[model samples]
Target: MASRPRPPPPAEEQVGQSLSLGEFQNVQSLSLSAARMILHAMINHRQKGSKDGSIAMPETETLNKTLDYLELFARFKDQETTQSVENILGNYDELDTFEKSQLASLCCVEVDEAKTLIPSLANKISDADLKDLLDQIIAKRQFMDS
Candidate 1:
């Protein structure tokens, strides 16, 4: 009888400690912070618009770009980072100055914040990458309850 073939290792099991170019390239697509910021911005922005003439939904382009980035990140989750979003961001080279500035403005959060995000988030997200933010907020809630 022929021997059984082995299955490939999971993404979390991939070799090496640092990010390769392939890894970095894979991550640019999605960002939790970016999505959350966009969502929040849309909500806040809509609230400011006058109710008079016409009501427009959040800008389609904003949603599209944010979703594109997030979906990309989500897709890569299984193929990389052991499906850990924190690992993905942690190992990457980070966003550029313009991107960073845009992110900072959108999130009112710094890149350092990504460093502390929990790995439980992995690929799931909506408008902003709030996995970390949400986790942190929850942690605070526990502290407050105590």
Candidate 2:
């Protein structure tokens, strides 16, 4: 008898009320600010570990490009502000981890805008609650900038 062929993988990843992250299903999602902090800390640790106290360039061109992109887009520059944003998002237990991260990274100002960007958020949170959350995030951002 012939052996059966294996099934093909999912055609695309989806993130709505249900997440279909494919290979990344178990992976923890991170906000851009958090990713930036982690990458910077890792570079600092490498620098500290080296004899010259200076880190080498990122191992790959992709990593170098990623670092540059994060530098340009990461919203929260300081740890305190990042933590505040995380805390605000964390309070909304209904949100998925991906949703929380997207909220922090995108920094959407309006409920409709957030819902349009992260469709899963539409059914999970009411407009008033989302507006309140956005306001809090905006306030933190303003404080950081000032």
Candidate 3:
């Protein structure tokens, strides 16, 4: 028999209600840092004259782009958009790939700060892909904490 479809994921308001202002700020900082690193890597790659094609930084603040990416990333946690979001991330190969562990260490968060995030996040998100992404983040946090 065909299995049942999952209910639509919580609305952003629902998700937002679950998190505090501090959590949102933390996520924004993390997302911005990741985006900055990716853009910086793209700049380095272009300077190095690699032929893979260039990823252009929009004439926008780094924070804006980072917020855009974070919004897109949240869609991945929605069942409807998961595959499309994954495809976009997979096809967009401009940034140099870093192993999750390496990425985590580079995030430079304090150990206690890292430790507090996992449970708060896990309680709110229901999507599998987001959970996996969160796990990778937690792993990175654990490494940094160490």
Candidate 4:
């Protein structure tokens, strides 16, 4: 014989508000959807009711300054040096403070080599000025570390 359908449980005997695994996954999915909605709202707010829906890139002065500094490095050096410098500075914004300090340390080696080759640098700088420049380099390094 066919069995009768089970009666619906009373409201108090129904599942409590506690979440199960599947319910938790649903909640996570909803949270992600909510975050996307919030981001959409923000972009819309930034657009200021434009009909075409084109979002403008935010101004990035710091990135421009960093690129300008990289370009200055490129101008002073050979083509290969410029390419290498570009590769190093391309992701400048991604580097942390320690990585920046490490880059400075690498530059100190070049400064040391420059000091050694100063006498051979066409003798444009006088001995006193070179001495002062070396002193300044030392002072700058100390000041940066502090």
lDDT of 1 at 125: 32
Judging by lDDT against the true structure, name the best candidate: 2
Residue 102 of model 1, lDDT score: 28
lDDT of 1 by residue, 1-146 (tens): 59888876545522122323333435443345444545556666676774644675656786778666755442222222222433333432433322322222233233244433322222233225544543433343344346
Best of the candidates, TM-score: 2
User: Candidate 4: which stretches are off by over 4 Å?
Assistant: 1-112, 115-120
Models 1 onward score TM values of 0.25, 0.84, 0.24, 0.24
Write down the TM-score for model 2: 0.84
Reference-based lDDT, each prediction: 0.40, 0.87, 0.39, 0.38
Worst 10 residues of 3 by lDDT: 94-103
Ranked candidates (TM-score, high to low): 2, 1, 3, 4
lDDT of 2 by residue, 18-53 (tens): 667777776778999999999888877776667576
Supply the TM-score for candidate 4: 0.24
Residue 35 in model 3: shift from native, Å?
Answer: 0.2
Error of 2 at 94 (Å): 0.6
Q: Write the per-residue lDDT of candidate 3 for residues 14-34, one digit (tens) a residue.
A: 222233333233332323334
Stretch of 10 with least lDDT, candidate 1: 74-83
Whole-model alpha-carbon lDDT for candidate 3: 0.39
